[model samples]
Target: MTGQLRAAIYARFSTDMQRDASIEDQIRSCREYAARQGLKVVETYSDRAVSGASLMRSGMQKLLRDGRSGLFDVVISEGLDRLSRNQADIAQIYQSLLFAEVMIETVSEGAISEMHIGLKGTMNALFLKDLAVKTHRGLKGRALAGKSAGGLTYGYSAVHQITPNGDPIRGDRTINNGEAAVVRRIFQDYAKGISPKKIAEALNVEGIPGPQGGEWGASTIHGNRERGTGIINNSAYIGRQIWNRLRYVKDPATGKRVSRLNPESDWVITEVPDLRIIDDALWEKVRTRQGALKSKETGVPVWDRRRPRTLFSGLMECGCCGAGFSKVQKDSFGCSAARNKGKAICTNMTTIKQKDLEARVLDALAHHLMDPEAVTAFCEAYTAERNRLASAATSTRTTLEKDLATTKRDHGKLVDAIIAGVPADQVKDKMIALDARRKELEGQLAQADSSAAPVRLHPKMSETYRERVAALIRGLADSEGMEEAREAIRGLIEKIVLTPRADGSGLTVDLHGALASLLLLATGAPVHRIARMAAGGQNDKSSAGAELQGVDMIDKSVLVAGAGFEPAAFRL
Candidate 1:
């Protein structure tokens, strides 16, 4: 309609398993299409692993904003579906662009008219509905057959290999023994009335990664209550497969996805007792406690919302039982597990005076970080220990590099063999096997490289590190902004596990992450030695518990201290 058409490109993919290159491919096609139409491509926007049904996507929003600003006369995409699969969302997007006098051109559909938008949008929407129906039907069938219907769960791995006929063989959820042990531990701990937050802390301290191979969150372990979903509420743990408990529906107004609870009658419950991870008694205990907590939360007054309790609200955990320490009474923090189920349920029954805990934490921060002598001592010890770890990891790195290179070479050879006319079927199997090995080796090498890299002190460590750390501490400490302070603490400390002294004298402050590194630096203490000192070696899992205790206070503090702390074992 105007001079050389200025076009903007939009591309998206719904899931990460879809190659990231899908976005690039879509953009490439759109550019080619624009070139053919004598259009000048001005800008390109892409949202990877984002659903088309949701306009909450950053790229989509930016495209809309730019369209409104009259930055482009034409918007180009690979297809109408790339813009949106939801009929309402597509109509809205088309109208918004049309109102701005911007025209949409899809590579497949050419220029979009009002009729094209109406018909194509409806068709895309219908296609999505049909896909959902087919997916649900297949999942329901799988559930009936006692097979997993979705992604791999925490304790189980999906059997991924296809059958000879190319049909994916189902009903093959194999329990990962290593992860299963952690699952059992979670059930046991929860049954004993240990809070999810504490359990997460214990797992982190023991260097046991969660489902996503990262630090665990309470939500990840406890799950959502409305849907009766999550690792804690999953009926799969009780030897039953519950399908269709929740559905994600796109909101017409916002073009965003919202999760809705499905009716019980609609849920397809399947019996698979052999698949159960938690025992009946443990499941019952956890369920009962969860029900009680839900009731408590439901009755809480609006004014008594949980967020305002303290600066260290979610960061504190019961050192003994690994349950979260929550604000029990005014100016006091106590283990939620102990408060809910009594001291009989949890041994960490002592309530910490909030002011006292806060003071000690701040003091520890100043003493270990702000003092010039302490900073020098910490820097020296930190650098020495880092060098030692780097030396130890050198051999491991070399071995992994060799393994990766060999696997890649073998993969290249297999590819060449296939090109040279081996039986395609036989060669295909070998290629798959070789590719899998190559991926595994590459992963190992990548991990090795990351771990082997030394955590170095800032260049200003000798001259200005102390002043910088002190200023950072003061900025957080002097601020009345609870959110800012909380955020700073989160960045500095991985966790603060509070162990009530068995002698009833006081609480032992165990630091973790960067905090531990800083302390090790200041004290020139070995990891286990400091951990023992912090934990007082009072409980079972003495070494682990002790290490956990010592590690609690410091966590990500190394980063805060301007002396980076990697969670290397041999801390000075």
Candidate 2:
């Protein structure tokens, strides 16, 4: 029986700071142990730089799956804690393996039992808690002593030195003159009523690197106010170092860390006046502007708010500067960069009435788009792809049904064994595992069965598309289900480009409809291939708009409208 038994090696180390060779060493030791135990080492699994606190690790999950499938009769790890540190997780792992008739043996602990899991898991959990408390305490002391307690802030550089006792001095920082200038400029510009988006665009145009040394974006400058995260909210700019303002906890469902605000009483504030980058007056001005903006937003009704309320609010772009077009007045949209960052960044100041723009776009979509030839081409390609995917899904559903049937059979055998006088304790874990696997397989089969049916193209697809567009236009005038119709129509458009007419008369509109969305709207069937293409398409307006200037399709994937000076002709 030992000679026939198959063994699998498993190992894990918590962080990148640990040695990569640690995994190799653990696996080698496990192989040697398996050889001595007269078992064939058939597979190896390891998770590098992954914590034992969660079973979300890919390697661990694969090991469990293979065990349940009866690929391995025994699992070897360096220690019980290597599998899991949490008591509940370790117990669950044990039960899962036991139900699958797989034994776990650690090099250090030998064969694992319930007693080992309970004792070792509790010890490891306590160790993690103690480590966190001690680490926080040390950081708090460093903060109180006027030293950096976290990652180095953007405008500061680390000062490395050695203490007299031969220990390295950590957390000392000095102001970076170059970065300090940028920080001061940001504060000054925001104080003068420049929006964060405008500030970011202007800085990017001048080739200024952001906090992470990449292209700047509005969110980088206007981070969450309540969490005090953005550049403008950094208290360090005012000679204050605030520590413990937020606490992070791991989300059990997703195994990701999320931050929560800590009480002000728990905060540790230190004065590092030498590192000051912004003056009190400039800081106060930024705070006042932030407050005023917040108040203005709160006082407005939700429907009339400055946020994206119109159909094409976020999809409109300026042809001159490539910045987004936003509402500049009560009823008109203009280039945001030109109005906010001045003419230096963008020269286009053209504005168009919201009503006129919508009317023109809707008219183009209904009358000029949806050519018969293009619709036919899209239908053939879409039907072939949909049928291929449907076939693959059917094969997958068959496999799931087979696995589910096997799980149910195994569970019935365990029940019969219990009824025949086998101790329930001996096979209870296996029965539970089989039941869970059966349910999981059944769920997957149900999802596969519920997938959209194979698409059959309508003979008059283009006509249907035109009729749908007309209905959508009518829906805009009605109050009931207006939002739904607006979203449906908006989904068909990738973006709209607005440029100042050469004669300085008005804005020239260029509408680009997404090919995938158009095909879906026309056929009333899902087209997975074209949908992926549209989703993954580049958003660089300069290159895309130039390529689409007078063309119907760019690389046979997009539909362009307003190909020439006339703004009402949509082509595909």
Give the TM-scores of the predictions, in the order they appear.
Answer: 0.52, 0.64
- Residue 187, candidate 1: Cα error in Å is 1.5
* lDDT per residue (tens digit) for residues 1-572 in model 2: 43588899999999866899999999989888888888898999999999888888999999999998989999999888889887778888998897577999999999887668778988988988988899899999999988999988989999999999988898999999999998999999989988787888788778888788776766678777667788998999999999999998988755678899999999999999998899999999988887777445366422223565787778888989899998889999999777655565678988999989988888878876766766566556556666777687778777777877888888999999999999999998777668777776777777676554544566478798888778877988889857667766776777788888889999888777765466566765333323333344344222332222222233235554323222242522
Strongest candidate by lDDT: 2
lDDT of 1 by residue, 1-572 (tens): 66687999999999766899998899999888988899999999989998776678899989999999989999999999999887888988987896566999999999887667789988988898898899889888887788887767788877777889887687678777888889889888977888877777677667788788766766667776557655777778788888888888767655557888888998888888767788888888877777667436476422223555465667687878888888878888888766543444466777878888877776555444334544555557556766666675687677767766887888788778878987778867567766765676677667667555444444344344334335445655565643443444443344677887769987887644345433333332333344333333212112221232323323433333323343421111
Residue 84 alpha-carbon offset, candidate 2, angstroms: 9.4
Give all candidates' CA lDDT scores.
0.68, 0.77
In model 2, which residue pairs have backbone atoms overlapping below 3 Å?
99-430
